[model samples]
Target chain A: MKLINKRNFISIVCIFFTLITCGKLLYERALNFTDRYYTDNIFTILGFSVLITLILSLHFYLQKFPFWLVIIAQYALTVGIVFLAIFIHGRFSTNAPTAYWDMFVSITIPFLIGALVYYICFFVQIKRANKVLEKLNSEE
Target chain B: MKLIKTREENLEENYLELHYDKIDEETNAVLDRLRDTLRYIEGTYEDKKVTIALTDIFYIETVDRKTFAYTKDMSVEIKEALKDILEEYSKIGFVRISKSVIVNIFKIKKLQGDINMRVIIFLKNDEKLIMNRSYKNDFYKRLNDLKGRSAK
Candidate 1:
């Protein structure tokens, strides 16, 4: 976000909100996924912050790629991340959920929603900018 | 600022020229506008020399240190560095997007930005360019100027 700049006040605000949001998700996961809850710590907070930042930075870089490529890459990346987490926790059991595609659905749907929100916000920003440009043009 | 008037009548053409002891920022900006309006940078294409009107260019980009100008139907390699070309055409409409790219705001069809960090600038030719976050402000400022002029 443009909030992450040299200005201390704005950067701090951005970081504060980021931590709050990520921390809330982690807390919810800890309540639901007990086995994975043990790994939560300061390192976990730091890790989540870094991971979220990297994923969001893709929005800026993804413009260089085609729409379809971005979709495939994002899908692969999300699945890869979930697999990595499972490996780290040593959860290798072949459950019924795997057969039913539970893990895949859980990981992919949120990412799709994220992509949707991103485009909606993008359209809103463009509309606002065009409106301002129109107002400026209408002036002397 | 000083204004000097001359009464020399020209039979062939009439024009204004600036003779300044030192070129300040404002004076240099005015000079850039005058030069870009009348100047046509030469390029080589298909083993032939082609002169490009600065305003007609949609964008100029450098790939592997070679600069090419993109118009509607022509892609001509110009004998100029990207930075130099930007300076020469800056007053007309071009603004740098990335390290190796500069685009003319007048040629842009639409602009959209995402939270993902990249802004999409659609050209009149339907080609899209990624607007780096670093150069977004300058691009919009130039766009505003272009819009104002079109309205007038």
Candidate 2:
């Protein structure tokens, strides 16, 4: 079995912390506007968690083709989650005004954060690879 | 360039660091042989200067009465015939896929073999060469040899 190195371990810890923080933030925001929305759909919550897990897993796997595919998949998943949020929020509350705008903001924020994180990780890997190439060239 | 030093453990054998400019076997062999051949020719053909690099070569062809080596930069009239050059560089992955032409295997990007019994080779520099049916066996054997060596 391969042991967890310092970098990978730190990355995993940060990802888990971010997921937890994001989930709590979503829950708090949903609760604050409970009169305007229904934030207690178990299936939607589970789907969101699975989507985040898949993104994190893809980020770690680090293959070039799959990384790009995963980014596209993440965007598709964000769209699905947005639709689910609107559906659930509408189903639970009848007299509430159109909370679709709230759903859009909630989905867009996480989507942007996910994209930023993915690109940051991708750029770092590219920098690391270029450094290795440069080192090989210099040694020659 | 930043240098990294890390302690690595081995299970059975002592570690030895192998160093080179690039890792691909075909490329390294082609570059090394090209350099050696250029150096050798420098002494023999002092009046006619020839500079051959991996990138300079376009497609080597035989037309009319002489074998001509075409490059993006310049063309060279080799004293050695097509057969002689092919035999000499066979070890360096040159395969005679047709009667009048021997191509640098490293320069080839893809090979398309069709039911019409013709093999079309797409080279890295976007030139295409047709391989005649007569030399198919020899071409296949050379390709297999290269693949076996590279696998190891």
Give the TM-score of chain A, superposed on the true chain A, for all candidates in the order listed: 0.52, 0.51
In candidate 1, which residue pairs get closer than 3 Å at backbone N, Cα or C atoms, i.e. clash?
A: A59-B116, A60-B116, A60-B117, A60-B118
- Model 1 residue runs over 4 Å out of place are A1-46, A55-63, A90-113, A128-140, B1-32, B35-38, B44-52, B61-77, B96-101, B109-152
Q: What is the TM-score of each candidate against the true structure?
A: 0.52, 0.37
The lDDT per prediction is: 0.67, 0.56
lDDT for A32 in candidate 2 is 80
Q: DockQ of all candidates, in order?
A: 0.15, 0.01
Docking class of 2: incorrect
Give stretches of model 2 more than 4 Å off. A1-140, B1-48, B54-58
- Residue B7 error, candidate 2, Å: 21
Against the true structure, candidate 1 reaches a TM-score of 0.52
Q: What is the iRMS for every candidate structure? A: 5.6, 17.6
